[model samples]
Target: MRTIRVIGIGTGDPEQLTLQAVRALSEVDAVFVLDKGSEKADLVALRREICARHAKAGLRFVVAGDPERERRPADYAGTVEAWHAARASLLEALIADELGAGEVGAFLVWGDPALYDSTLRILERITARGRLAFACEVVPGISSVQVLAARHRIPLNRIGAPVHITTGRRLAAGLDPEADSTVVMLDADPRFDHLDPELTIYWGAYLGTRDEILRSGRLGTVGPEIRRVRAEARARHGWIMDTYLLRKPGAE
Candidate 1:
């Protein structure tokens, strides 16, 4: 089996795709792209653009869907494990078919594969079983955090203040060792409703795409606005990848 290079295509912009990423895209003999669901059509389009820009002659292409995600049952822990298992199974098949023919394969990872992305971990599990033999490389790109800060033009941290990266789920579960700034990602639960929001908010959705929206203000003041904007964008585009940085008063 040939090595599979997992490429982080970055947010939704062609420019955000790194040079190294382009090279990886061109070099692979085959590539497998994930189609999570219909609502994520824009994501698939972004991959199409990448392939159009860098895919070279003789490179095989494959598209795969997530096997299935089981709803968390009463024993939530068990359900979570099952979900990972299902995803693992789907990826295993893709790897075998794409790489078994002695062709190098790659998967397009949204954002950087190292940041809260599970493709690398799943590959690790598959490789451990000896069912697949492959080398992997992660090509980094601009993250939403960096893009948000740039658009807002505000330092993510105050003098000597630390920043914590968390998700809407973790924030709702209860923030940990609270820092001066907390970055919220995968914001499905509208967690800002739980925060004071007076400190600051640098929110962005569909970052780098033409339909991108960015806003910043008091969380208490901008929370509803962000929600509205997020909903309208989701409705307009069928999907969203928004993030925000929140802070406590006087921390900035």
Candidate 2:
């Protein structure tokens, strides 16, 4: 049976890859890539650089066009389900056509696959269809959440306190009062803009790369600065990937 390794490539920094992840990359016969477009071409190029550094020479890269989906839809969950289905179909064909018997294929995912990434889920969908016969393996890597805390010199959770990880959409609805510390990911908008002034925020963008940006302070005082800087960085780079930590004072 063909094997598919869902290797977590961490963020952009190639040095962030664990020895185990590097070993996995070196073994794979082919790596699958999705073309996200010109604006995010740097992301694809970064993946190629990583493969060049770690994988065996002459490793094949199978690139496919990423399916388009609505950025904002009335039914967000439904839209995402459809999008995943499309991706599963695309990847299934790649696996069937490109992967030979007993050969290894890989998807170099950003951060940890167990996090917000959809590659694993898409693979599962293809497997559930029973058309593809491949074994799946996951190699973990450093996540941006860890990098954020380290860069900011702050613990993700207060002493003996729990940390809640959520998205920007849920953050806008409201935070759970009991949440001592919250980590927000995949937030394009500044949902923390209207939050309590006393809350502290540690925000980072383009994490683990040379273009990394970090900001932290009371929400009220630094909120505007974050907004302005985030906009300028996005405009300059044509894309942005960010995550943040929000904590209540004396939550512990």
Candidate 3:
């Protein structure tokens, strides 16, 4: 059976790679990268740089086109499931065609595989099919959320209060009053505009990289500025990966 390593390389920073992840990369015979088109070419470049820094000298890189799905589907979960199924199918073919029996292959994930990433789920789907047999392992790395807190010098939680992590789509519905802190990820749109004005926001974009942008203040004070900056950054870079921590009025 072929062995697949789902290694987390962290958010766009080669140095964020853990020692364990480095060792894992050294063992990989080939690494698969999903091309998300020219708009995110820098993401692909970063993956290449990470492999160059850690993987064995002769390690191979296999690039494949990522399947696209609706950005604003009526059924978000269903759309994502379909997209992941397509990814699983593509990755399965790549592994069967590119990897030799008993050889080790890898997918370098952004942030911890246990987070919002779909690589683990895609691998599960592939295993469920049982058409191509491979053993999978995960090596965790620093996440963008961790970087956000570190850059802002704030903990994710307040005292014993629980932290809520949610997507932009969910955040649009409402913030949880019971949770003292909320970390919002994968927000293509600025959904926080309608949130409580008194809340404080610690936001970061393209974190752990030189292009990192950070903003912090009362939501009412910096909300508009963040929206402007975020738009400019996205337009300039053609892509942006951002996350923010929101603290209730009295939580801070």
lDDT of 3 by residue, 1-252 (tens): 899999988887788999999999999999999999999999999998888888897899999989999999999889998999999999999999999999999999998899999999999999999898999999998999999999999888888789999989889888987888999999898856678998999999999999999999999999999999999999999999999999997735
Q: Across residues 54-86, which tens digit of lDDT does each residue of candidate 1 receive? A: 988877768878666544357757776676777
Error of 1 at 252 (Å): 4.2
Please state the error at residue 60 of candidate 2 in Å: 0.3
Judge candidate 2 against the unseen true structure and give its global Cα lDDT, from 0 to 1.
0.92
Clashing pairs in 1: 197-219
RMSD of each: 2.0, 1.0, 0.9
Question: 1 or 3, which is superior by TM-score?
Answer: 3
What TM-score would each prediction reach against the true structure?
Answer: 0.91, 0.98, 0.98
Instruction: Tell me the TM-score of model 3.
Output: 0.98
lDDT comparing candidate 1 with the true structure: 0.79
Pairwise TM-score winner, candidates 1 and 2: 2
How does each model score on lDDT? Answer: 0.79, 0.92, 0.92
Q: For model 3, how big is the CA root-mean-square deviation? A: 0.9
lDDT at residue 191 of model 1 (Cα atoms): 52
